[model samples]
Target: MVVESSPTMVTRSAGSCEWTLVAEDAPVLFPDENLAPKLLLERFSHDELKSGSHRVVFKLQTGNGCYYFKHYKISDWKSRLQNWVRSSRARIEWDHTWKLIELGFDTCLPVAIGEKRKGPVVRDSYLITREIPDSVQLDQFVEKVLPALPERTRRQLRFELARQLGIVTAQLHLKGVQHRDYHAGNVLVSWDETSLKLKLWLIDLHQVSFGSKLKTKQCLRNLALLNSYFSNRGNASDRRRFFRSYWQTFQTKKNGRPRGFQEYKSTLLTIEEFCDQKMWKEFARADQKWERGNRRLVILEGESEQNACRGVSELDRDFLKAVSQNPQNTFGLPLLNKSVSVTKRVTLKGEQGILSGYLTVCDKHSKPKFSARTAWDIGHAFIRRRLSTPRPLLFVEAKEQQWLVTEAIPNSMPLTDYAQSSQAHHLNFQSRRLLTRQLAAQLAWRDRCGFQDNHPTLFNILIQPDSDTFFFLGLGYLEQLNTPVSEKKIIRTLAAWTSGSLPLSGITRTDRLRFLKRYLLEKEGDWKRYWNRIDSKVHSVHSN
Candidate 1:
């Protein structure tokens, strides 16, 4: 049976069991009744477009033209039932492409669609669309093509492309069409030789949905997904121009230029805030779902965290035993507090440098209490909370021994090292003040987050050479207070800063008070009491 809806698109029945869609009266790609998608895939010369558990796509050449064939596979009863009720992905994409084209938007031309069903469930489905000729992905165009062009040409191309993108996005929103996966990879770019203009065609329409006039939050989400790419490739001014162009096109019939600075600023702020909030929520969810086993500690067996590390060892029982047994791999001297703390440095593949593993032991049997695994988890927590700290590489438990590996910070000295050295007196005045101010800000932030570091000391902070950035070393015992961090924790941290055993003995009460003002902000009496306590503690230690 055959049906020709258009000269380009043809729908026909293939053999005894298969339905097919193809271009220009072309023969069926799959003719065998016994053949499955996988077996059929191997017979053709094709480049894979995408391969996942649910669907697989390939760009293959046909007698008619180059076409993309996407095979949707149902692996389980749950997906089968859902797809059966909601319509197969193939039908959705095929219908959506036709609708979008009818709505005056460019998209890949659907050539054919097929579905092989079993009773009430769709077991397998396929969608075929003709490939756009002379097209490149927008990201690829930006990365490989734009940088090679002349400066003037590059600027003109970027501006024009951004303007066109703005127009299309505005059109999509105003028409109430929302692309769920609205990122750069789904957008295809082509240059028109005759018009001397650029054309864009959107793809991956299976998830596309239509609604009434899009709300501001919905529009912002779509914009943020697009902005994620531009934020990396384009400058602030470029992004601003893109948004401004979008607003102008959106308001073409409704209003003139922005009424005032405040309105314009508010729109920009909304976009920024929504984007940030959406991105953060995604990051947090990703972090939570990153592993399967324990939330705090998961054994790394070919997990992403292992691959993410620069010098990650192939974590296994034998590898852990080897690292635990070797002393040359150990950092610092051997076993003073054998049951308390131990560290080792492991070299990496290539010239990627080394990683250090520090373990906190608990008892005489060298059984760990807090453990290296805990430190690894806490390090990631701090990072997700936007605090600067050493990057944890891997954690492994072997023979009841635990190890945590972290990237080594180079050309850095502990804050205590700076305070104890002769260089302490000759330290740059601006550098010292800057470091102090940054420390105040970090402490204030910690307090706000209800964090109290029990071992707050100069030794716990590592200042990178000639940079405002610093890494917190004493994270193993970091605690979350049930209540907000009290004034006592603040005072205790400040007292550690003024501990007179080090070079800061030359610092006066006025200097301490001024430093406190940066964080405490106008708590003169509290600052005085904190300073007196610090002085009294130093005096008492000296008297003892």
Candidate 2:
């Protein structure tokens, strides 16, 4: 763990690219010719891990083993100048990783570092690290592998996993290093077949910070960052155990308690609040991206980015206008429970042969700007949020009339139609349970996006006839609340779902509660109270 000498740079004849060997151990293993960035670039493309704006990561297979190579590219003058005088991210990570290993923490071992410069500008750079063999991401292991184990084995594994992660996190804090992007995905857990214990290692160390012991706020932010990803994945009890184990280790390191009981409890609350606030911000940003006045979309529309007549291509604005002019021209079927809306399939001949789309002309309430344009924006919003809606192609405003053209979804049936079929009744109990659980989960997710549909029901959804996957069909009413959604909103949506789908779909009250339990990840005792309170509220509203 000692520095042999200063980092030596090798000038390669290929353009301005150069190789820097920081650790002396690298040259002894990887020959100078093979370590060239140009040679690495010429290697097969199949081992690529990821390509991003800042860097590209790939794995190189050799007789020895596999090595990870991350090449950083400076995209702008600002970044180029910044890295010219200073070490690149690859170098920083290379140095920090060695520091972590020297401190007796498990992390990826650095192999080599490379950079491509244009005169004084650092153009492209990369760092190489040896892969951690027989390891899987902590998140993937928890989601995919953990559930298949026996109950006793699973319980033991879960506890030990949490304890080890807690210990590592505490150790990092004690060493005054803050892993800014500390999430489950960044942590690797390797199992030893003989020892039956998991070894935890942290990866992606470029953002790792080193300083004096972290402040209270800094500690909370670090812990909150780690907890946020697991918020929905882990059950309340599992999360509580992890938090308790982490805090216990944290306090032990301080030789006593870090703060008074009340203060410490308040800190935990602060961490929860911080995590929730971050989640809300992400939701808000996503919600805003679909709004009518979104700057990017507006610019896109003005620029006529695609080959289309009348500032549109993929969708025919002229056809949409014709549909709006005379709705009766094409015979159409009416959507159930909705008299104002009508859908007719239309085909347009394009350069790519025949393209099928749906034209929906609906009557709108007499409100300012409440035209087809609004529905057009809302449809895009639904698609952006990954809701199951026909993708909107274009929105045409013809006088007071509204017309929306959308790409048609094939091989799908209305949720109501699917629910009443013999297929639904004949489905196995597990399939039925999975369908119900997914529906509840979607409702929960939509609620998180601040969508408060006044008449939420299975009738407003589309289901894949074979797979049973469902999509939200009624995007016209999905107005963005643009605020942090409350639990009450979710409860009300769940209530509507039960009232609308249960009677017709032959779903019993107990099965509905079971679905809710899975969505909420609630324990038996907690679920009972939650169901009672929500059920009472639903009944009171109906009776009134």
Candidate 3:
């Protein structure tokens, strides 16, 4: 079953550097064995497909057909030493591609490989493979193409795709191939329009290990990595279907018997545990993106020694410099609020074109340092939990004051304002109920993430009229809890939102009950008990 390609190797030297090229002898592409290396090395017309830190992928087109060229450059001593010890990345991928092909697994066809070395140290390497026509990355296909199809057709395609992925993954594990970076982006999905037949191919083979049986840990880790993308994009039922298919296929291959309900349940739980660990690691990585001196972020010192500003790399330095010098004077449009901090709406030009942001300046007596830092931390926390909030952009610290800049959410108004607007009257009963449910769900999710808002008034929340999306404001009032919020605290938050000087409009008793039901859906408590406590707290606050 293993058909090996007869590849011809050619070595060329220029000054003190050596170049080695090995190419498969395919008559259609490489008619001349020696010339194939020169052609690929010298004059192949290419368009860049993707570029990363150390690797650049190009799509090469010739008389034969389309091919992908993945070039890997070793810039650091660590990478050079690794390559010297275990050979180049191209060589590893070349071997792995052939093995996968021989095993009858769908993968890219490795055509040629080249390495540039000087005195046993590889400086650069490249791998060339025949491209799969009309194929897109699995993640892209799901996000872009699937939604455009008919509802019934999309469901059928998704089911088939999940089933096929499970089958292929199980076969790979049974054959002793473990893909370390087994995410959706590394997999390619292609489909026929006429018959709606789908095909999947695994690519990016360098990190994969061969001839090593997968242990439980290895299996769970790989599945978790794959699930990370789907966990956000697909629902729970989709994931359950995928896991069931995988379990059935793996069991059939290993023991020729189907797994029972308890066994499947146990396996699914283990997989979920691994997925949670993966998510935590991912959250840590996201947090690191905002660290000082990171490539994505920059810090700039102002002319005055006491003044300094930090912002995302894309922000224009001149804008940040102006804000660093005097933030209160930079934005003259005052925002309506009762806080002691000076808040204003500002529009600035940056590398990303025009940016509109809210600028808050806190003086020394108001603890500007703490205010700026807390706002920054809370903004990122909302992002980590996938909750909607204003994106924190820049922070300026000075001897007398500090400034924090956050992106302005477009087409949105404060929740209280939205409730009083004509838009509230336009909504039907069902729409109002849906909006209340969504708002309550967001609050519940925030609570589950161990965050509590000191002031849970409608004035601190924003709602977009068109999409009904909720965005939290007043980041300075947000706090992280060391433990779960107590029942008393939960009731107090509900009472604060309801019994403020300005009562929330358009919400009836029925709507309040709907909100409570949704908020308590995940909490471990009797709904009526929570409702009774909340009602008593609201009445007590009103009486006070």
Q: Which regions of candidate 1 fall more than 4 Å away from where they truly are? A: 1-8, 15-17, 20-25, 28-43, 63-65, 191-197, 253-265, 291-544
Best candidate according to TM-score: 3
TM-scores for every candidate against the unseen true structure: 0.56, 0.70, 0.71
Q: Write the per-residue lDDT of candidate 3 for residues 381-474, one digit (tens) a residue.
A: 6876667898888887766666788999889888877776788867776678767877887888677566777767767888877666788877
List ranges where model 2 is wrong by over 4 Å.
1-34, 117-121, 134-164, 189-200, 255-264, 285-298, 301-442, 445-449, 461-473, 482-492, 503-508, 517-544
lDDT score for candidate 3 against the true structure: 0.73
The sequence of per-residue lDDT tens digits that candidate 1 reaches over residues 474-540 is: 6655775545577777667766666742465434354456567666642334656666776777666
Clash count (model 2, backbone only): 2
User: Per-candidate RMSD vs. true structure?
Assistant: 11.4, 6.9, 6.2
lDDT of each: 0.64, 0.65, 0.73
Top candidate when judged by lDDT against the true structure: 3
lDDT for model 2 comes to: 0.65
